[model samples]
Target: MLRLHRLFAVFLLLAAALAAPAHAGKPYQYYAVGDPTDVVLPQPKKTSLVLMGGGPDVDAAFAWLIQKGGGGNFVVIRSRGTDAYNPYIYAMGGARSVETLVIPSREAANDPFVIERIRNAEELFIAGGDQSDYINFWQGTPVQAAIQELAGRRIPIGGTSAGLALMGRFGFAALNGSITSEAALADPFDKRMTLERGFLLLPELGSVITDAHFDTRDRLGRLVAFIARIVNDGWAGMARGIGVDVETALLVEDGKGTRVGAGSVTFLQSVGLPQVCQPKQPLTYLNLQGQRMSGGGSFDLRNWAGYGGATLPFTVSAEAGVLLTR
Candidate 1:
């Protein structure tokens, strides 16, 4: 009887241990190309910006803009989605004036026609898909060069979902989800996830980073995780996570600053977080300051001025990245 009781106690202890939540080993790290606050007003001759809602029929709206902007002969680059060859082609309807280029893979990303269409295009749009694919395939190829050239010429470049993610100077690759979800809420210090370098290099835009499906999907947690990774790796003293809710878009100008369009954009500013040592253990360091500011709300990017000012929610030891939506 005594032996049986001891065995039962051991089994109970094991069960309790198994019931506890498992902790990730470490957190992911994300890097930026430049500072977020630095806004460069483009030359008047070449300045155009566009934003697309995640779930809405924007064909008519885009068509109208293209026609008005003298972009009757436009080009659409569809790199994302399952049907890569004709990704998001329907979004334009039969807008006969515009031409479409569906790049199925990284190999096709550098096709001469693709490059020519992108370079000559007055407006460029990237379809929604896994952003990491954009980074992996087009980061340093001729297609990327053409996109940059279009930007230099002052043409509008827009994206949605993964497309939106690639717009920022720095972008999250979604390498692993373990640390991403947890770190967004609190400081989960185990830096387990790995980030891809130079994935979204928009140097002219500075070190701006962007994310999609903000409030609707409750992405606050993952945004915080991104900030933690940036701070932990000494990438930046402060980081900003721009969370875009579904069916919304934020319009950003070179010098005029950011403006809200269809939906709200949540800005997650991380000032501090609890320090942790190992996985599954409570954080020791506390006294962290995190704040959520929205576009056109009390927190205005233009009003914030440089990295340091009263307009900002918290004092950033280092400049945070910028985030855009659409």
Candidate 2:
């Protein structure tokens, strides 16, 4: 009888995945692992965010999230993907159950039940997919409101890749697809460089934009170009760009950011306007303060400099759409 029940459950899961529509559509998808009932564990909470680069899951970082999450209901939310994370995160223990919410459209983002599922989360992880779906579907909707409330409650929240992209207060929306470092340096206003503000609106990440697959994708030049746009657009007097390498994660809390997993986390800051940044032309940005930290290093988010990382101040310039480095 137990074997029959297990087989039936697997059948149902396969059926659901098969039944789900492709892309944006009415109704949302949900999958769960472990205990069937939602458990709201009562415990003191403190907010922490994990900025994960696109790659293999960071075990230590997720463990930290589960720890900070109060060992309660862990929820994974994504615009696409399957229940893969559910079992993956659940196997890590500490959480009562792991659930995945597949919210695919603006209409589904407004669904009361969907919003409620999000509201009940103790720890929320935004899985990798297209950031545009999150922006177009959830931004300014009740879904956003629900997430804001969860953050207000000081729950552990995280994201990776497209998930990590929108974690910043200001970020590249990727609405027009991804812009390369070379293309961005050539023309900061390239159509592919579609940047936007006020997605997560994490005050802790004030005047900041984040990029993923940093080293793997060679995104530094583009991130610098992004800084130029943010400063030029009057978003803030000073702008910060955080680029996390593949398999790396930044565990942030209490005004401090610590590196975990593989590779290094890059921190770049721009305080002055670009000497030459305009549409249809190359870029000229100078003296950007940068720092690179490997595993176990910590950064002082408040002071913009901290122990355990290498300081790397650099400059970038372009001649007729040709990027030149110093």
All candidates' lDDT scores? Answer: 0.51, 0.83
lDDT of 1: 0.51
Q: Can you write out model 2's per-residue Cα lDDT over 222-248, one digit (the tens) per residue?
A: 998999999988888899989999998
lDDT of 2: 0.83
- Record all residue pairs in model 2 with backbone atoms less than 3 Å apart, i.e. clashing: none
Model 1 Cα lDDT, one tens digit per residue, 1-326: 99999999999999977653222121111111112122223333635444443655344446433543454334556554332212243344432234445565666776665575566555566767666667667778887888877677666666777777667655676545334444433334444444544443442334445677666565655555555666666666655556666666655445333434455655555455425423444323323333333345333343334222212333222112111221
Give the Cα error of residue 119 in candidate 1, in Å.
0.7
Q: Which candidate leads the pack in TM-score?
A: 2
